[model samples]
Target: MYVLAVLSVLHLCCSSPATSQDWPLDCTARKTIPYHSDNGRLFREDDVWNYTTVILREDLGLIVLGTRGVIYALDINNINTKKASVKWDVTDTQQTECTYKGKDQEIDCQNYIRILHTIEDGRIFVCGTNAFNPMCDYMNYTEGQLILQNDQEDGKGKCPFDPFQRFSSVWVEGELYSATSMNFLGSEPVVMRGSPEPIRTEFKTSWLNEPNFVFMDHIPEGANSPTGDDDKVYLFFSETAVEYDFYHKLAVSRVARVCKGDLGGQRTLQRKWTSFVKARLECPVLESQLPYLVQDVFRLCPDDDWNSCIFYAVFTPQMDSSDYSAVCAYSMHDIQQVFTEGKFKTPVTVETSFVKWVMFSGDLPTPRPGACIDAEAREQGIQSSLDLPDKTLQFIRDRPLMDQAVQPISSRPLLVKKGAWFLRIVVAPVAALDGATYPVMFIGTDSGSVLKAVDYPADNAADTFIIEEVQLFQSSNAIKILRLSESTGHLLVGSEVGIVQMPLSSCGRYKSCADCVLARDPYCAWDLTSGQCTAISSAQTQAKRKLIQNLQDGDTSLCPPSEKAKMINTSFVMGSNVKLKCELISNLAEATWYRGDNQLAPSDKHHISRDSLVIPNAGSDDAGMYTCWSTEGIAGHVHRRQEAEFKLTLGTEDPIAPQARSASKGLVGLQVLVVFLSLMLGILVGWNFYKGHFPLPCMQKQRQSSIEDSQADVPGVLEPLHCTEDKTTAPAGNSNNNHTDLANTVPVDGHATEESSI
Candidate 1:
């Protein structure tokens, strides 16, 4: 539990910087025509049932299915043109007499019968709910619909008859895998794809009390097989926690898995459900609400590096109360071990101990092809079941981590943590445009707004989570997120109104334009001409400036200490452009630009960058301290770089900044004025004290001198000027002595007062 508590703690870890000026969440990048399947919305009339499921095809086009069961192939690449804004109609194949087509359908072509479809191998596989008609009919036997054609009860093709049923289908390795459970009559959970042979797992309950399949995703390859180890699939569902006269009080979240080869075959008899372990996922805050319902699970697939095998799910314990919801996550590797080892043998419910989890160090390595090591343990000749120990998988189950806080339902676009093991991404809300994406996140809102973001630390989690509306549509609509190509960095987003495409290179990426210019990250960076993020030559400028800074201070070295240790000090030729970046740490610090020994005038070129000095278009003439000092912001602070000489001697060039005489004069005058004011204040204080008002110990001598002169000096010595009352009390000896001293001081005319104060 200590490991669990510590792992759950969310630490503020710093990562890389951002690179681009991302689009606002609500701006619509592009618009695509949405095709609805039926005349009315799926359930609500106002809510035009547009796309419900969307996936990018292998060739870069988009395949989306509307809630009304209308399937469309949006030619994303053709529609997303940069300069031209034109309208194009999407090709529809709904009118054909295809399998799963509605029966008694008038030529009006408006009846609702189909569900959704998965695209693969140049053909579309479709399925639908037989709830209204209850009969699976209408198929064109020749086209090979590949789905919705099961003949278990009779040779005629039809899906297992079950209403109130939820199903999901995905194409894996050119074949479709459908996860479906029966509520009307069947006793087992089924995974099929129109094959007569179906893989089944028995976990029966009442008809109305049917279980709901929540989510499914792929796991790390070759880690949990007996002989032929392959990538496995994960399924999340809310099953019975306890059987009773009435259905169980709560639906418990459970995890299940099926191998690629085990999809549709004679594996029905053997309950070889690899990861069929049940766990009670409970959020203390959400468990006490009404109509306790499980929040939908969102699956994130890794981009390239590590296989996190992580799945995110949000649960609203009181389904009736939307506010009381908590987001919970679990790892598939952990679930696999719990089932394979048979640990914690108990029914599922929302309890803390139900789903044991683990976190891997970095991302899990992808498995090799044709790997069957995990699948060989069950064979009689196998030496041991734990022959190839997957420490990474076991590690995740033992020390799983969870987020401490749950974000709002429609937060920001989904963003992935840089270097995070799982394909982690954040989805958030934008203004109106449904959503946008960088690479990792899918951001959208329940209110028809969305933001798609990748984990670029510079953008920060708070900003990344908010969906920036890329393009606003005319009406409110739900948007689907898509990352068209990582290599090209194209984001394709589609809403009920239209489709949008944007090239997101800047988001959370580069720390500064100089950094981007140096690293050549294909993201946002400094452009001299336009002064914006654009494609340009970055290395030449970065290298020259880096060389100059290294020669001067060696402190601006971007390389780590260990790497710098191996490098030899060197110099390079100055190119056409260079940048001098001077960092001022304090907010109050003012940076002054200088060339050579003379201070340069603060010009447009000598500007303060984000906490640093930027020589926008640095030329040989513009070399130098570019010294930025903090004189007053945080008082008495002086940060000066004296040897900051940019020795730019052209074929024949004289010093340029005799022009900055004004800056130099101003600085010197300020210093002199400060000194003069101090002396004047001292003289005024001395005079006041002699008159017996606000007297100071240090001015006592001056006061005594004045009194003595007033008494001793009468005609030539100075008269003893005194108050009328004090004259009577004045002694003859004191008066005479004061008059003499006053005579000497009077000749000076307060000269002594001025000299002493100075």
Candidate 2:
């Protein structure tokens, strides 16, 4: 237990996040079910045998595997935090016939396993190769054992002990219809079902040479069935269907349908099952590449609205040219016509060959498709066995499941089939990075490394597939399988070493990064005024410009406080230099620097730093309320922040920017003189005749000529004599208007002579 705990901690430490410059910190993985086992421990070490086949039953929610002919059922759904319990184990009862003394040595004789098909109402059926030795009657299971029972109850048919190497079975209503091979090398192909085993079919020629059973699924509505009813089971597999003249060297994928009613009874075994006829599946492209090792089949998804059912398949080739060896597709209504016609009406012939796809789109075909090879051919004879109906020979056609069995990054399309657009995204298998939710594609190479990428769409077909290669997982063993988490969207990557987890959110940050530049995205821009990355909006540019102008104007305190504003402490020593910081609202109309009530002057020491205030040679005068006030038109109101209260005790007798201080005093004197001059100039401009003249306008109007000499002022006041004013009247014009002379005369106030410049 202590060792287990230590190993767990070690595993965590080893899977830590990547440090600087390490790319692909996270990646996807391929794992076996044992990795998710309870206690997280597999069978006692040295158990190297892998599972030959696996079955997932929805009703039981159990994952059952055939390992060395021993059945191990893991109720995966009953997991406590990704930990599964080993529910049941079935051992081989036939192992007693072998001479092996121990449990470990007896495992080799049991091999070549297939999945279980539910027969009739409740019984489950499975079969495997007995290693071709009559002594190897005893097989192995995980928990219990099963004895080989070849002797029939009634002994009606030849109960020859047949060891099926490769086979597939489908259950309709209650009976099981099986296609199986006879020998390990694959010699004959035959169809048989049930104890009464009514249904039987066989073909004479080597029609299904090394044929792989791909799929068996129920047909939905609108399927082109000969009976015109959609209630049928379709079978998909890869076979060699050659005519007498031509070399049908190319792989042929075929589709055959069987009605649910034809599964059982004596008539099925006796009659030559021509009812299991096949036709070439139609594809738009010529020379389509056939998928190799047409292994597993699954129902993708059904769309009742479109009258369509989709299927998916896995193709793992022993020999492939490119990294991409998997293919997925669907069947369209128009393509199904070839099956109904029982022949390829027109094969899209090209230089490249073709094969049929067991799984297309998301749903499986009508019949349970065979995986690896047609079980009927294997059951009849061996790999050399044939299962061709007479009518199928006339077509002598080719079936292609994919294009270019292996596709390079450049040649692959963004979409695969006519209906589904393929996105060439590869998810990396690196630790922590693998489990991310980004839509990624993962490529497991022949070498140990796994490549992860984003399928960024290119502008056209000629352009290469744009892949954001995010990570690479370096392992020493081949990747077995990849499981994507549907909920968190994290990729659970499994390798021979262990499993790795990567969250998708962390991956988006480096989506556009190149292989070399991911570690150092150092070109990050910060606009001080906007307080965000410079690429955000136009406000950033404007704020940046304002910050520059403020610096030029010697206003060093530029950066504004954060929204949840707080004061930060920063200072320099008095002896050397000091910085008094003030944060001004950016783009403000005017900011005042105040030391108590005295306003500050713009100088080198009092100027703005890049975005802060820098003060050199601190002095007492530089102390007190160093505040930044902004009053821009846009602000609608003034804002102030007292950035610092510098109590500078002069460390040095001398001051920096002394000329600036002296110039500022001079400016004050000039300002006072200008104010006085402005007042004098206003009085002079309004005087109309003289610089210092002063008079009350009301008094002047009253003293104007009244036209009567003896007018009003005679009551208790002295009056001037009008006759004395005429004494200096002009002589000749003398005779005229001597009386008017008094009104034109100037008033004298104790002066020697009176003058009227008026």
C-alpha lDDT of all candidate models, in order: 0.36, 0.36
Q: Which number leads on TM-score?
A: 1
Minimum summed lDDT over a 10-residue window in model 2 is located at 512-521
| Model 2 misplaced stretches (Cα beyond 4 Å) | 1-48, 57-61, 75-108, 111-113, 117-126, 130-167, 191-195, 220-230, 244-249, 263-269, 281-297, 303-306, 313-328, 332-335, 341-758
- lDDT agreement of model 2 with the native: 0.36
Tens digits of lDDT, candidate 1, 1-758:
53334233222121222223121221221111123321111212233343344454544344333333333444445433221111111113433332234422222223222333344444444444333222232222122221323331221112323323444455565444556644334444554434445444434332113456655555546644334555666665565544222323655555555555442212222322322224444333211322233435655544432244445554433232123223334555455444443323212234765442222224332221112324344453423222323442232222222211122222322222211011112332111111222223444333343333323233333222211233323335544323344434455444444444454433223233333332222233344443333432232344322211111111223432211112112122333233444443222334565554555555676654434444554455554323433221111123232212233322333222444667778888998998899889988886665444564433334455545443454222222234232223445565543223222223344333211211
What TM-score fits each model?
0.42, 0.39
lDDT of 2 at 644: 39
| lDDT over C-alpha atoms for residue 300 of model 1 | 50
Q: What is the lDDT of residue 140 in candidate 1?
A: 20
Per-model tally of clashing residue pairs: 91, 121
RMSD in order of candidates: 24.3, 32.1
